[model samples]
Target: MEYKHVVNRIMLMIALFISIFLNLQAQSISDSSTILIQRNLRYADAPLEIGQDTSSDRLLDLYLPHTKPMQSLPILVFIHGGGFSGGDKGAKGNVALCKEIAAKGYAVVSINYYLYLKQNKIQGASAGANMKDGLPKDGKFHTGLETAVKMASADTELALQWIKNHAENYALDTNRLAISGGSAGAMTALYTTYRSKQKILPIRCVVNFWGGLASTDDIRASAPPLLTFHGEQDDLINVAYAYALHKKMKELNIQQSEIHILKNMGHAIYNYITKNEINTIDKFLTSNMPAYE
Candidate 1:
């Protein structure tokens, strides 16, 4: 009897140890990966020779996955939005999204565009030195929504052209490409996706998170599939803009546009305002979209 009891206790200890070991190993495999990408993905940091200052307006950050065997991967370009007046490509907010997308087997690029460079000049409009009209329109540091959109669009087109001329070097599939953005960045993605007439990047789909859409006819013209997420309670860049664009796309018979209006969400879905939206965006990227005709 004593021998049998000892044997049972030993068996129980062995089973517990095995269970703990397996659990830890399973966690190690299920958690974040350790794949390290060691190569610099080819990308031009110069502005398009056509418009804007190449010195300040041109600069792109490319992120590539560390997948072995070097298979050709899809592409995703992200444009950050700081009201188009101030935003950096190196911000943690920008790179976090890029790295997340890259982990899912895609190459990602983040771009920085010219900010509103208006120098403070309290002249003519100062009136009697106490006349406050609105906001300072310093020539060296100023930008509006329309101007920002145009400049960002130009920069994006230039990047697309660069990729088109050198896709093979980057190990990218010319046929599979996508664009995404937050706030002004979202506007940039939509405008860039629809405005261009050339097939430089051949964007397969788009992800617009907390961004507005312009009335650019090209959105309806190309009508590439789009997935947009916006907060219903957004104060800046009203939610109506999203629905308006979707309505127009539908009218133009451009199907395959998905819009997720998160309840009680606000502007800046991926960054400061609403961080949870980033995971939702990731899920969208994971689910493949149907081929465009």
Candidate 2:
């Protein structure tokens, strides 16, 4: 009986120690004064009367780190992918990813842009043709895609402009701005930063997840540091696109650019990126953006 009683006491003590350790860990996490997330911020309003019609897809969600070192934080603006057709700023998976990035001591914004559906009859007609025949019969297929990409790029630029206009309000360091996106959104991010006429912010880095530029020519000697993630088996947007971009980056002596290819992975690499991959991205961003360090 005495031996059993001693065993019970030891078990009780172990349980108590575990409980205390868990409480301490929880407290440590809660006490860390970092990571503030704000959702549904209207960075820009639609129908800006900029020579054409627009939609209400100009909203964005922000993730911020509260522990500001110099009262300024590096910013990452993310655009969602839907092939210029469909997608939302508040995607659950992306929001979770942005929050994780924010926890790593950076400001993150996921934005929405004008879709191809918002364009005039030309876009509608081209889209209809694309739906029937995987490719549009109208020689205007490329033109329509270009127009859609340009519109989304324009909206992305407007979002950046909005951020620049409200930098102090958001505690953002415009000098360390970066852009990221998936697929079409990734294309928009690259296009907007590389092709836009209005150079609002000095982009520090780019995170391209299975994305390609509308024009490879946009890549110049002055292009910012780039980190690309693509799947080797991506059928929708061939892995070749990423390889081509990396080749150009190398040719241009953009030593800071890198492409990570996931073996046997497909177009949905974004959905399957592991925690370790995210950590790698965090490390890349921190290494490139000194403010995060």
Candidate 3:
């Protein structure tokens, strides 16, 4: 009887040890899976030049994923809004957005373009007031604005070309590129991708946040797909621009284009980007430019 009792106790100990070992193994696997799913992203602030100009306006900031995937990653080139006379690549708002995009597996680059009003000063009145006055008698006013837009577009195009040339060094997928910006920056992006004569990598799509073109007449069947977000109550650039562009795209049978007119929203769409909007943008990008793998 004593021998039998001792044998039973030993069997119980063995079972307990096995159970503990299996539980520990399961926990280890769970921890590792969590770690694999969660990754850290990295960033590089401005002073990174993308053009021949050494001025701050020609600089850019970059955001990269933590882990380098086997395949090159798609990139999002962001332009900042300052009415084509201001704004920076390191602007608080732009940096935040770039980080968010990088976390989602995209390499993001925010660039600075020469401001139209910076070099050409309209004596006395501020840029805002001058813009409101419309075509000043001195003629510098209208010319400045036009030159600003043209320079901005040229700088953006040069930046795109630079990215393409250095894509391999940065682990970027040059073929799967997207351009985005807010307000004035959006205008620059639109013009650079659609109107610039200098050929570069084909833009897969565009994200226009309250951005408009001087004329949609230049839009062609070959224009890239577009996703526009505009507030119905936008006071700066009329909501008509969004509607007009949407109409043109439809007329041209551009099937992948979409415009989301947020009710009661204004020019500050960037401040109001919700999870639903992010998800929608993600879906659009994914559908248009799938991951390399």
Which candidate do you rate higher for TM-score, 1 or 2?
Answer: 2
Better of 2 and 3 by TM-score: 2
Each candidate's lDDT (Cα)? 0.64, 0.74, 0.73
TM-score of each: 0.69, 0.81, 0.74
lDDT comparing candidate 2 with the true structure: 0.74
lDDT per residue as tens, model 3, 1-293 = 99999999999999999999999999986544322221111222233433433333566677777676678988888888877656777767776666666767787877876765555565432334343322334434345555666778887877787787778888889888999998878877888877777578888999998877656777889998999998888777777778878888999998999999999887755646643467777788777888755
Task: Please give, for residues 1-293, the per-residue lDDT of candidate 1 as tens digits.
Answer: 99999999999999999999999998886444433332233344543342544324566777766554255667788888766556667766776667767766677767776543221232331111211121123311123455556667877777787667767877876677788888777877887777656566677778987776444344655567778777788776667767767776787776667788879767665653233454555555555432334
Model 1 poorest 10 in a row by lDDT: 125-134
Model 3 pairs whose backbones collide: none
Tens-place lDDT per residue, model 2, 1-293, is 99999999999999999999999999888656556777677767765533342223677888887665566878889888867766676777677677778877778888877787444436343322332222223423367767887888888888888899888887788988889988787877777766776577788888988877534676789888889998887777667668877888899998988899989887745556645577888888877777533
**Which sequence of candidate numbers ranks them by lDDT, best first?**
2, 3, 1
Clashes of each: 7, 0, 0
Model 1, stretches more than 4 Å misplaced? 1-57, 117-143, 216-218, 271-293
